[model samples]
Target: MHPLGTVLRSRYKIIHPLGSGGFGETYLAEDLDIPTTPKPKCVVKHLKPQNQNEVLLKIAKGLFNREAEILYRLDKIHNQVPELFAHFEENGEFYLVQEFIDGHDLSKEIIAGQPWGEAEVKKLLRDVLEVLVVIHQQSIIHRDIKPHNIMRRRQDGKIVLIDFGAVKEIKCLETNTQGQVTSSILIGTNGYMPNEQANGKPKLSSDVYAVGMLGIQALTGIPPQNLPEDPVTGEIIWRDQTNVSDRFAEVLTNMVRSHFSQRYQTAAEALQALTQSPPTPKSDRWRSLSNRKVIATGGAVLLGSIMSLYVVSRYFAKSPTPPNPQAVTPQPPIVTPKPPSTIKKFSQLPCDSDQQLSSPPPATGKPTWETDVYKYYGQINQKTKEANGRGLMAFKQNNFQYYGDFKKNKRSGCGRLSYPAKSNIDYYLGQFENDEPQGLGYLKLRNGNEYRGKFAKNKCQGEGVYIYADKTERDGIWREDKLEGSDNFSCKGSSASSMPTISFLSPKPF
Candidate 1:
């Protein structure tokens, strides 16, 4: 190991030893050549060949230079990868100086026996997989991927992969008299390595297995080696130890499958599966409405309050797929009802006949018009024939679907608006004016963020409470959707009334 304060190439002043691996030792150093108030610090990796044979050294040098060139390209392409400042051969020793990430390793956050929540684990998977996507796109495979090798950057809280196995892999290189190169040693942790990887054949999916093991360790609160394995199938038996959704569990399982071919072929494939939204179940559609209503009411009335709404008999004609109360398209028709329909079905609606309502509404929109993406059913003005009272708008396209009060076809009363498919916002349940959210309401986002308090012209204004996915709560005043000040605010009138929007008095049959 280089002694403390030792200077290399008359430039890098070695500060201290970082760690030692099978092939090399790392040191923290200061670059004196770089002109800065405080000299920039960098990580120096010293790789020493096991043998001094002239033929072996020549082969190793070639391999080392080739790997360094690719790493340089990777650094320029992705900020997450450390930038390769310089590489040199000093007295038969190979040294690599690179950008030093100012953050602790993931092992600190992923403490053994201290499990992380599903949301946090999911975020970690995305952060790591995104970087892997860029790395793999360049036809490079990260042979070694573990918690200790992944750094959680303090500046922006991004994940940075470190300690590429090029140096370590070179240790296994050997050349025969025929001048052919061969490798025998595997380059990965045993617990995280799959069968193929352990056989000295690491694939892109090998890195995916390591990341999957990291997630399992966080979820189960157990080290990868300590986790039980299925002896018969040779797969890790970890599902019983964690409380994760079945869909998410399946993704993780597929990533860590024992067979490399059975797993996702690339990081991009794995990331897509992780973030893709699962199809909503058929039974949970109306139950979600009742549940949201119960939550909005703070469990004061439960399902009984929603049960009081008058149900139109037309909804009973067909059992449709369950719908998530989120918007479908960028534009919707509720804000401005269409002109008098030539279909003549508007006059056929049973608006005056009232009846007791039961069960929940289906996901499909009524009338099934080929051009119309949404259909509104409720009170209509006798003279103008426009939506004039409480109504339920079902959407078939990607746009906001409103369930609330209306005046002259404009959303101007207490109601809930479902977000579109691509929007980060989930559902906004509160008061509306001129077809936009206004006044108090509860807004839920797809990323597990929630805002409750006040809104004006579709922006978060006035005092509100912002709850982050990590369970951090911020009570503050916001302007134009940005938090400006911290203050106490009450969200009392945000809840919608128990009165249903779709009353039996006005029903538009398909």
Candidate 2:
């Protein structure tokens, strides 16, 4: 337990211990530097590495620093995310200071065995999804998304996402000479975590799955683990237990699909679907048009036009003297009304070729899969090769799908690599060589952050412009993944001219 009234760095004085976890302890503290009438309360997290081994300690320190940098980046732009005050190492232990939110976590409000109303559920989903959109856009995923991690702001009743301690970096696991797999640390709540996440391979969609579980728990008043799942499909069977509209059920179903490919690709997409109006049936639209009073009015006009035509013919035949050409008045041409064009139904709309509505085969088929390699080769007057052509490739093991030109079974020429349901750098579209990003290309991380410019060996190198999640741009030369110069990057909309720079610390030591 952290000692009460303990001051660190002669600035923040610990008021009380909030909680403690396996890796860290949290405390409510007051910032003494601000001599205002009411001292600002902040959260101080003490991160102590569990292992004394140097290698494990180094990894833990690197992860801790990386998380702090991520929080700093997000807090600068987003209001829902907690703001970082300061982070430092004291007595070989790391401590992070952040803005304390004065609100209760959702766990207190969301009680087990008590179902939430439809309107309340909808509001909850929207609020959380909006926050997630920002978190994901910043290329960060709140790995541990649960009722306890969400706080409802007392001032505005807005949902705030907290606790990014479990945030995981995008890295592939390794194997020893014996071909045995060495797993990465799995970091997610058990019931809320999807299969992929439980296996230590969480994607952006994994967060969506967790959110869906929350929704289900709210609606059914049952925990996710206790909810019954279909034996064959593995989908949670909660419709019978709850009374939600079919449309919302569909959205939730897609969100918590067993396969990541079938889930909403992003929080933005999920929010759009959740808020979208229900589609009106094509038959109902046609029925309404047919029942309209316009048809009766059209019939009366047609009868009137016929009678006038007869009267004009009779008068002309009975006339003693021929009417002068100039004296004959020209009647306005009778125009027939055209029925409305067939209402195009939603089902008739063009299908998204990339979207998989159902469970796709575990393996997407052959490696040399190209939809039209011959056409591409013919356009260039080159013969197509089995191992080389322009097409799409799916690497199931790494959860990556590549679409572009391939040479000798490698990603060559131009191509795009995407993680179908994950965030961070979601995809890279640019020049490729030997199955890696090379030369110039554009990279979009899952959190809406972007980088355009030169690349080498699958990393940002040379001259490039990096756009942060807050729409701030940094134009500089990059080596590996860090900016070259010591000059601080300027952030837009911020009073400070220079942003804090974090050194590039490698998670895996070479």
Candidate 3:
């Protein structure tokens, strides 16, 4: 353990040890470099090797750097994710400096025997799922998600996900017949982790299960491990323990299904279903009636005139003529059409924007045709004569073309910016605002590298993940096309400066 007042790198001065675990220990420290009135406090995680082994140390070093990189990237992606300030290795011991979240963990709020209301549980689920949506979008499955790992910030009360130590891929000094290192390091809490995660084959849906289990604990006032399960199906049997709406209960049941395949594949899908879930009934009688199920035709069934003979006998208690089971004609089940989506569809655009022209000339030679930065075609404002609504714009100078929705002469909706004349395929297809890829979008470069995430002002901003041609990914927050963080390590080869970098400059095709 680091002694009090010990300063590492002549910068971070340790204040006190926060906690310790099997892998490492965390300490609260102060950054002396920043010249603030009160030295900003940060959390320092110390990862030490079990023993001095050359091969094991090399492997652990690589794993530690990779984990730090992941955390550094995720920090920029969302506010709820703690920011990673720096990571370093001092005297064979690795350390990570992170943002000190000033808040208490969910364990304080979700106490045993102190159950939360349905509304409170629902709010927690929504908050966690929203953060999971961002994390999962980068193809990351948070193996460990529990009350202790999640904190409620004291300032704003937002749920902050902490402690990604489990995400690190570390292995012991054990080799198989092929001389490849092998170690089974199962990462996750017992109660929160599902079966698949426990077996070390975790999926995005596995994280969803953990979040659902947390919600159930909050509602039932019982720890997830303490909750009873079905003897046959192995599903959690907690409905009788909590007073929640059938709609919500069904959602939670599906989320915690024993089979990963039965659960929602992604957090976004789960969030959508949860948001659309109906509210609780005003009366228990109404809920009971709504929850009623239809029995088989041969048994007691409840419907208008299709009541079975058994149902008629029990309800009426009188001899009534029942329809012949063999003669009864079965009617097709009625399916209610889903409500129209609130988001406007790009296909609803009035003009055909997919048509690509070889040059900047219109086929019909319309007189409204004009040019500024590029040749414009399709619809135009009758009064202002500016490129408005759905249209196509081609720039011969940049050898680029744009096709899709436009508003008031700006690309303000769904659109595709591509370079047809180029030897390689390069394009950006997604939401646009003022001729820039704004909000969620996909950018694929000619070199096979791709970026999938949020953008703003023609730059990769907010949470995004850049996928290299070799399949390795870098996930984090971006501002004006740059990742925001600093890394200075003293290890032999674990310095962030030694790591390779990639540029995501906007092509300015628009």
Candidate 4:
């Protein structure tokens, strides 16, 4: 209808865009002014009407305003959820600006699929229980604990719960949401929702049930529906579920029990059981940003969120370029017990001295994301001429090197980063102020792709360009790390997806 890239309510300058679900659009924006801010990019999710019905938009707008009222109260107590940014009505459209997560959704991870071995499910549930404890302590019910609403921040691989506090999330996780329309139309998804929630009563145990089901899903690659379920009883069908332990199954059984009384009555109880002194599998992914404090401020407006988010210092925005993991193509269904590989370390690199420049990665076959599974585990110095002129911070887990940057313990710089190996590719090197990749730097990827530019907080925010291995080049402004501004005539085609040349205000909570 309106031009494609229309700027909403004034303050939010959309960098590029994230996905748009039943909720409204999400953007990665920069706060106009604020240095050393957490979540420099913000996600704008304008409230969407529940139904396509005409009058519903009007009612939805009213309910949308109530969200801010709710947040303001919660903010007073340091709620970890998103802060209410600018909420406004312009041209009959209502909008909201909030925090942005630089990570993948738990649902996407589940759908894409991974195995949950040993105490993996227990650990995941325990992490959730802790969040719920905080939420319950705050007197809030995150009725929607489904995968889609739960995000895994790539920074430290921690789960950052989003989209709670809404009547919709409340309705979905706790009450009979789908195929039922009493006070509210069915708000939750099918399958994972508990039976009580499906019938109408939304309670704490209902969340426990869904979370239990999430455990089964995590352990088994199948979705809840695909898992066995009693047709008459509507109970989870767990008989033929292989690789699941009796004790673990018992844990889920008590959790997802049909009746609320049969389920874990409270988050504390659930947390207590899950927290049994069991040794966490070293390879299981548990890194997270939950511990990081996020300080939000509009001169006293953004105080609800913690002062920082847990994340290794590095840029996180990825190019929209489709993932081509064909190099690591393996047999379908990656189940089966495979001992995870260890992250390679620069400390383990040959010639750990300062005289000779560390050698560059062999320039023959381009290294696939798989070839460098342990790449993130080590400090990669592309500057092989002498001592550490430039390098990336990497860790190891799940057979790859997770990467980023490390100077002290702060995520102080930027580069092409990846999850698990949890590493980053340093494209530029130089001075840093406020953590943005300020000063001069050069990034040379193992794939022969490279970029040398002036960075701001890691993004090519000021001005920069890249010369690809195939000879293509891009020039523009970067928001988080993706390009946002217009590219030159020739660069437009190849640089179409990643908005690296973007510009916006830095992220400020609230």
Question: Model 3: per-residue lDDT, tens digit, 1-510?
Answer: 889999988999999999987667889999999999799999998877765577877777787888888888898899999999998887777888999997567775676887777776777798899998999998887888998999766434467999874534453334568877654456788888889888878999999999999999989889999988889998998999979988899889889999999999999988988899475545743434334433344234334445565565675565366645444434445689965432212111111112221123442354346455456667866777666666776655655667776777677666777755343446776667666666666666667776666666666677666666886666666776666562421111122132111122122222
Better of 1 and 2 by lDDT: 1
Model 2: lDDT of residue 147: 90
Residue-level lDDT of model 2, residues 21-116, one tens digit each, is: 655688999999998968989999887654355555556567667878888999888899889999887766778899898755777556688777
Return the lDDT, model 4, position 222.
Answer: 70
Predicted model with the maximum lDDT = 1
Residues 328-347, model 4: lDDT tens digits? 22333336995432211111
Instruction: Report residue 127 deviation for candidate 1 (angstroms).
Output: 0.8
Model 3 C-alpha RMSD vs. true structure (Å) is: 22.1
Superposition TM-score, candidate 1 onto the true structure: 0.58
Give candidate 2's TM-score.
Answer: 0.56
Query: What C-alpha lDDT, on a 0 to 100 scale, does residue 314 get in candidate 3?
Result: 79
TM-score of each: 0.58, 0.56, 0.54, 0.50
**Candidate 1 local lDDT, 39-100, one digit each (tens):** 99999999877767777788888888998998899999999999999999877778899999
Q: Scored by CA lDDT, what does every candidate get?
A: 0.72, 0.67, 0.70, 0.50
